[model samples]
Each structure stands twice: as structure tokens, then as C-alpha cells.
Target: MTMAQRIGFGTQIRKSPFFDATLRWGATGFSVYNHMYIPRDFGDPVQNYWNLVTAAILCDVAVERQIEITGPDAAQFVQMLTPRDLSQMAVGQCKYVLITNTEGGILNDPIVLRLGKDHFWFSLADSDILLWAQGLAVHSGLDVTICEPDVSPLQLQGPRSGEVMKALFGDSILDLRYFWLRELDLDGIPLVVSRTGWSSELGYELYLCDGTRGDDLWEKIMAAGAPFGLQPGHTSTIRRIEAGLLSYHADMDADTNPYELGLGRLVDLDTDFIGKAALARIRDQGIRRKQVGLVIDGPPLSGPNTVFWTVKKDGASIGTVTSAVYSPRLDQNIALALIAAEHAVLGDRVDILVDDQPARARIVDRPFYDPKKTRPKAELKAG
Candidate 1:
């Protein structure tokens, strides 16, 4: 039997609108994110992983906080926040952006959604980016208002997700292209729906505009998705690891640069931003360590690793495994590791110290499940 600890709830850590619904549906574990409680698991991780891949799953990812930026200079001010050139980003489109410090360190990787000509939302990861944007705006004299709006997001993900969405919102939702969003109204409740998700599966995120209707919205989705084998689930570490998705504060952090994390494409040197100079310098200097994928020779891991497992080369510590899970589909323990650039080449061998015992491992390409990534962006026919 595995020992578990109880998580005490308090006002300091806010609860999502679907908190009660998640509890009633059997949320077995919880974790704190963005000062809010995120449902970590419902039951077995392996079962949840299978469910997400085979059918559909409703996730309470309202822990993804939103920071709204609006005003005349909103576009320019928002552009100053990241190295990505946002000049070509059309309204109703979303871009995965990294908010870096002046030192070129990644502060948070948020989805930048353009809501209107002068309005944008930074759907943040697990960091307090509101203060960072506010502080920057204060000194820059940009005519933009920055604050967290009353918006919360819930994700419906899986192969059958499009069918559930079509059932709930009709055929128009099917027209939404990948990374595009549209304002929607369901039963008089206003929302913003986006074709995006953490899992590399077919998914959509419904951003609840009205917090008071959280329970009602949750029930409505549950009822609509019941016929499609939908279940309440948390984000699966196994699926994410298989997809090579990076979790903030897990695979990378404030001290980690985007280039080292395989996010160099996000940095546009031609466009000036907060970390442009530093990133340019880093690009010129080159990175010493790079994040890479690993396949390990071992039995299934007990659970998701809590700390970085030491990775060694010839008995000397060279790097660490940031995230790892035993992939049932691949039949091997896969991991995302930060290793010396020299050792990050494909097929390079290394040793991973799991539970103090060294296990043989090799460098491999990521997205261990689907290399083509066709599922998430595929068009689904209406049922």
C-alpha cells in the first residue's frame, strides 16, 4: 500500500468554480498551482491515461490564471513582454509565448490570446505573471490596463472531444482552426472556446466568463459528454511525457532559458523584447546544456518522480531527469532530461539513478507516442 498525505485547504489558496464538482466526482489528489487548488488525479494514473487516450476527459484547469491586457498600446506593451514577434498574430488566434526576465530566463510559458484589436489575455502557467506585467507597465508608461479578469478555463480532451463539443455547441464550433478561438454562448452563459490543450490530443478549452455559473456549466458538459464516455480527469503525466510537453516548474523554470528547453524558435531576434538582448547574447554564446528525451531500461516507475533524478556519465553527475513516467504504449520508462549538450545527442548512453540504483538509458527524440502530431489538429466529422 502507498502512503498519502492530506492537503489542508485554506482561503490563501483559492478554489476553482468546479472544485465542488471535482470532489463529488472523486478527485483523489490535489496540487496547488497559481495559488489555487488543481485536481491532480481522480484515481489511478494509468487508468486516467488510458481514459484520456481512448475516450474523453474533462479537466478543471481553471488553475491556469489569466492576465488581461487592454488599451491603446496593448499590442506594443504585450509585445514587450516576450521575445516572439506578435505583430503578425491576428485577433482570435493564440500563440504559446514565453515571458522571460531581462536575463533571458523563462518566467512563464503562457498562451497569448488576442481577444480584440486592443484586448489580449495571457493564460498563464504556474507563475505570478500578473505582477510581472503590471510592474513592467508601471515603468514603461504604456497606456494599457493589466489585471486578471473573472475568466476560468476547463479543458475537454481526447479523440471524442470534438464530438462532445459538437453535441454541446453545434457545428459552428467545428470550424475553429487550431490555435484559434471564438466567443460562444451556451444556454445564456457566455464563454470563449479555444482549440488548444496541454495534451497533444484533440481538445478544446472553454473559458468560463461567468464564475457564478461554474457548477451549471460543469453539469451541462457532463450531461452532454455522458453519451460519449466522458469522465472527470486530471492532466496525465504519462500522456504529456509521451507527447514531450513541458510542464512549467517541472521541466523548466525561471532560471532555464528558452533555447536550452528546445524553445529557441519562440525567440525572434529581429523583434526587440524584454529578453531579446540577453537571448541574443545566449544565442551567440551557445548553450551548455540542452533538454532531451531518454528511454530507460527498467520496470515501470512507482509513480511520477517528485525530485529530479540524478543522471550520470562514467560515475560523474552530468545532468538530471526533470520529468519521467513509464509509458505503457512504448513499454519503456521515458523521461525529459537536462543534460550536458555533448551528451544530448540522439543514441547517447547515460545512467539514471532511480531509487539510488543506476539504470541504463539512452538519448532519444521526443513525442514518443505520435511523431507526426496529427491528432490534435485533425478535422473531425460531425456525429
Candidate 2:
């Protein structure tokens, strides 16, 4: 039995290539590989990459998630775990689904990518979602074999992603739509192209069959994008911080509900699935804590893991900061926090505890960076 099994917490596992590569890049550079620990002393990407105005960032997120479900009842078995109705999912389509426990806590956010009629892969968080799915399968007596495919995913994100992709893979890429995916042969090698990314920028995830092909794809994209200013980039937590995207375990965990994490849209409580009852209760009864945006009054926050937020209107601790960062895009210190539901209204002024000292902050809407969500889909050029 694994460590998770000994602890009886399902199948929690470590990331394959887990390490921090920030210092190796150079001075004032840092990166978090596969949702590991927050590293020390590194400048935010927005400060460094902003002058380029537009950038093509490459990220290796192979450890993000990879769960394979194969069996006669694979589709039906997986469908029972999510509240989103998957009966209409046609083959060759991918849908974002939330996996919830019986108490309605999110297990791990994963994308249900349909590879074929019988084959489906759940791209997941670092958490042990594979064990959870397997336990459910066995408990329900469903005959299915779940495993992770020997594959690594590369995220090519930035304004110039499409242009660079076209140069490397040809014009056929333009045919794909947001959230859509296709399998194609690039230079005699088969690859999967999914129009998805985490940077909240115009990006595409090319799932190469093996790690050997990754170098070729990387070199090809970089060479094609040299003119477009493409560069190797890992996950920019600070950039994502500005984007208002919540990181798992950092923002929300088993202790928090989706509604409290500003992700209620991801939960379809109307359907019959695990945690549907609990989620309904949370929605109807209302959440005590809410995720809110914080605009720091003082200097920018340097890293993740600091308790610099409070939900006090007039000297009372009502909330706490979950994720904080210095936003280079906004040129201000921004944070996401869980506060009393009443104190979460937009434009409400609150106090943030910076270094044990209270600093003035204001509650704002989510996505402190891009309000329009314009980066996911590229604009079609006029023919």
C-alpha cells in the first residue's frame, strides 16, 4: 500500500518531475514544477516579460493531471461521479467536470477529455483523483481499469501562440474552437491539440505521445516563434495571481466549498451526483466564507503562504487571505481571500495584515487581471 493508503486518504501521489527550476533559469527567476512548494525570492513574470507586450510562453504541465479509465462501463462509471450531465458528450469532445466527494468537497478539478467511445482521460490536479475514481469503481462493482497514460503535456501560451502554432503545424490548427480538441499528425508524428491553457492568455496545449517528441515540438515552436518572441516559461504563479485564477490547496481545499471558492459555476447541483446534496445545502443556506479580491494598499506581497488578509470593517477578524501576489500587470499588490459573506461586496474596504501590521485593502471582483477573458480564444482574422 502507498503512503496515502496507509493514511487512508484514497490515492494521493507525488508529481513525476517534482522540483523548483526557478534559480536555474538565472538571477531573479523562479518556477513551481507540478504544483509543488512555493519557492523563495524570484521576480514576477509580468515585470520581466511585460516589455515584450506579447509573449509565447511554454509550460510543461505533465504532472497537472493524467487519469485513464477503460472498461465496458467506463463512460457510465465516470459519469456517475460528476454533476454535469455527460450523456450528450459526443466522441472526440472534452468537457470540464468537477469531481466532488459525498460531503461536496471538491476532490480534484479535472477535465474529462474524451479520447474515444470507450477510452477517456481525466486530466487532474496533483491530488490522488485516480484512487478516488478506482475506489468508486470497485465500490459500485463497475468493471473498469484506470491508469495514467505515458504522456506529457506542454502548454504553449501567449498572444503569439496561434501564429507560432500555424508556422509549426500548418493552417489546420485554426479550425479548432475554444475547449475543442483534435488529433493530428505533425511532421509524421501524431499529436493531440487542445485549445486550453491556464495563464488566462491565448494558448494551446499540445499533448505529445512521448517525451522524446517534446524536444522536437519545443524546438519547432520556438524556432517558428522566434520572430513572435516565444520563450520557455513554467507556471507563473504571480501571473496567474493577477489573472484571478485560484490554485488548488492554496485557494480552496476539502475544508472549503465551491461556492466559497468563487467556483459555484463549476458545480451543477441540480443533477444527481456525489456531493449534490451538500452543495445544494451550501447554496441554499449560504456560505459563511467567500472568496474575494484584495487590492493591497502597501507594497506588493512577495510570495504565497502569508496570512495578510482580514475581514474587519472596524477592527474585527472575519476573513483570511488564501493566495496573495504582487501583480506586475496591475502594478499593485493583489490577493484572493476567504472572508465573511457580508464583507465580500465589491469595492468594500478591508484591512490586510501585512507582516502582522494592518494594511488598507479593498474587496474587488475576481480576475484582477483580465476582466474580459479574451485570451482563451484567438480572434479570427478577416478573410
Which candidate should be chosen as best, given lDDT against the real structure? 1
lDDT of 2 by residue, 25-142 (tens): 3324223334433222334455434522377766657665678898888888778778677877877788877788888887777778888888888877657787788778778877
Scored by TM-score, the top model is 1
TM-score of structure candidate 2 = 0.85
RMSD of candidate 1 to the true fold? 1.4
The lDDT values for all models are 0.92, 0.71
Question: Relative to the unseen true structure, what is the C-alpha lDDT of residue 359 in candidate 1, on a scale of 0 to 100?
Answer: 96
Candidate 2: which pairs clash?
22-30, 65-124
Which stretches of model 2 miss by more than 4 angstroms? Answer: 1-44, 47-53, 303-311
Tens-digit lDDT string for candidate 1 (164-269): 9999999888899999999999999899999999999999999999999999999999999999999999999999999999999999898899999888989999
lDDT of 2 at 147: 84
Model 1 regions more than 4 Å off:
1-7
Count clashes in each candidate, considering only residues at least 3 apart in sequence or on different chains: 0, 2
Worst 10 residues of 2 by lDDT: 13-22
